[model samples]
Target: MAAIPKTHRRVVLVRRPPGEPAETDFRVEEVPVPEPRHGEVLVKVLYLSLDPYQRGRMRDAASYAPAVGLNEVMTGGTVGEVVASHNPRFKAGDIVEDRLGWQEYAIGGGPNLRIVDATVAPISTANGVLGMPGMTAYFGLLDVGQPKPGETIIVSAASGAVGQVVGQIGKIMGCRVVGIAGGAKKCGFVTGELGFDACLDYKAETDLDAALRTACPHGIDVYFDNVGGEISDAVLRNINTFGRVALCGSISQYNAATPPMGPRLMGTFVGKRVTARGFIVTDFAERYAPARRQMGEWIRSGRLKYREDVVEGIDKAPRAFIGMLRGENFGKMLVKLA
Candidate 1:
């Protein structure tokens, strides 16, 4: 075995931000590597996922999950190789996935950690397409949105990690998939590359409602919402009767100091009879095995395509995360820790 280092680098949440987080909110510090206790394994993180949800974790407020306490390692999903072990289920050199936070190494295992097979896919995928984002897309779309053939599906943040998968899955279900992306470049990728029927550039569009109405002539039947600001208002206005909406991430509102209010859409909901529900990926944890198996099959067969926008090092995580919140990342944003 390679010699274990006595110290490692970690990014800690120094202070909760009032609004969109600045780089100063996080500080990189070198700390002594923790030794594994009984039934634990020490892992050297290789890839750390930078997601918009982590932005919500920065605030000291009530949320679905606990906030990252001041001066603690910023929580995140990671894929790493076990370098030392005191547990039988995991051992030296075993690649595994865990919520190990934004650190070079971590010491914990058991129920929260699962061994990953690199042969099935690249280990980095444990944080991206074949991981949380993928699972979120699968359940949120098929189970909640329940798209049907010839129906129209509109996805916000369409070039993003979960959005891309949600759009593709809508296509496979024989729905007319229309994506709402930031710029012309991303819009082109959504329609030209990912096979979406049409993509609207939200940044360029002067009247979003007209654009949506033009693109989705039949009206939106399934709205896979990733962003929840003005974009949602436009989509809600055009929802067909009996439409279903899967409320996923709200990246547009994540960085706000005060909750941004829009026109109440209760009338639309009542008139359309829209079914809207919010969900987290872990909400469907018990069924992950089968869902992952099917996603893996689609990936292997080339039916489901994915993209990754990976930054080079752990120190870049803060900037990458901020960029993601600003709609900068093209796909899954990750920091390569190795």
Candidate 2:
């Protein structure tokens, strides 16, 4: 159980930026610690998830997820330990799920939380590999990408949280996995540690077309798109007939002030008869147990590995979150609460 405080620190979105969010746009403010009334519990946040999708919500525009209002706390998933509870289902010391935003404390009511064995994995895993991003890679690849054994799969942002898991899972399933990440370091990690068959450094690729052609010599059967600008367009040009594409996060367009330019590879989709679909993790929340179970089994068997670039202190979450947008983070970006 955590020592309940009278006040707690929270990161507020003080201003909605015209384009990308600056550090000053977010304000670190202290608020009164809320008391849990009946059927409620107070959660002391242990870790906060920082993802590229959060960038879309920072803008005041219509999006899949609602925008964060000015002066409101930035929205995000959190793993927290319950300190006080008036609910029968939850009690002190129980670690639970929460969308508590960038805050140190939260009063949760109703049934949004999913109780977990905090010891099963590190508490932070629930916010990354064992959490939403993990499930996203699983469902997106298995259900959408339909990576068959012996098929050639190409995944972008290969060194990031979702991409690494997808590549590892693809490898385990007998598929040949190729990855695209920024810089030489990330490319090395993706090919060496993550066990991808081949990796291309997007930053170093002088000719994206040549790289795509060389990497996907067998013709790409599945494209796990993470950045949906020129990189995705280049991948689309080489897709095999009846290939599939999983439209995951589009970090390339996330920070753009205006609509991003594209290679306009829509014609290739028609010629290749490719199937591309966009999905949100919430769509498969019902199947979370199965995914989590599979992940646990993989982890125990050592077939799957997860890497997180954790930043210490809740006060630093804003900086970490911004860094993720700029592709400065490697693997899962998370902040340990102060």
Candidate 3:
């Protein structure tokens, strides 16, 4: 094993941007690595997960989770190897996953910490396909969307971390999956590689509503909403009766200075009896074991596929995160910290 470092670099939230966040909002500083006192382990972070939900944490507002206080390490999921341990549950060399923030070293063995099986898949997957995003995609589509076989399911932001997984799961469930992405390349990847039934390029299409109607001739039965705003309005407008919508993140409006005016579609929802539910992945934590097993089986048999967009060095996390919010990442956004 490599000798532990005395100091490590970490990114801290310095400013809370009311609109789009700038790289200057964060401060990268070197700090002394803390020693684990009791039932804790010191982990050498290998990969940091940059996700859309982290944007919500930047605000000092009431939310499902607490805001990331100014000057604190930015909150994020991390996959790392334990280099020192004061806990019996975890030992040196154990690969683990936890919300250890955007740092090269972090204290693990917290309530949220879990041992990652590096043998099953790459340790990075502990922050992706085998982690929170994967769980979010599974329960959101299967539980919230409640897609039935032969049903037509449409996914928005169809190339993002959660969106990509949701669309592929829809296909595995025997549904006709259609994806709505920003460009032709993303649209092509989803349809050509991920096995989505069809993909519509929202940027290229002048009339999304018309495009949706043509792609989903029978009308959308289930909608996995990742990017909300005008895109969601278009999908909701073309939804079939008794349609289900899994309300995930709304990346399109995350950076808005003020909430965008809604399209007032409650009347349509009432007439059609549409069911829409918002979810956080942890809600289904108890069922993760079985769900993970199934997802693993699908992955092994080539029924499931995943893509990652990784940037090297912790110093680059701020830039990568900003790009991710701008829809620049082609797949799951990750930072290689080691």
Best by TM-score: 3
Off by over 4 Å in 3: none
Q: Please give, for residues 190-301, the per-residue lDDT of candidate 2 as tens digits.
A: 9888899999998888898898788778989999999988888888888899999999978888777786777777787788888999999888988999899999888878
Q: Clash number for every model?
A: 0, 0, 0
**Model 1 Cα lDDT, one tens digit per residue, 1-338:** 67889899999999899988999999999999999999999999999998888988998779999999999999999999999999999989999998999999998686979988787778888888889999999999999999999999999999999999999999899999999999999999999889999999999999999999999999999999999999999999999999999999888998888978999998879977889999899999999889988988888888888899999888899999988999999999999988
lDDT by residue (tens digit), candidate 3, 147-181: 99999999998988888899999998899999999
Clashes in model 2: which pairs?
A: none
TM-score of each: 0.98, 0.97, 0.99
lDDT (Cα atoms) of all candidates against the true structure: 0.92, 0.88, 0.94
Error of 1 at 211 (Å): 0.9
Candidate 1: residue 320 lDDT (0-100): 90
Better of 2 and 3 by TM-score: 3
The alpha-carbon RMSD values of the candidates against the true structure, listed in the order shown, are 0.9, 1.2, 0.7
| Candidate 2, position 219, lDDT | 85
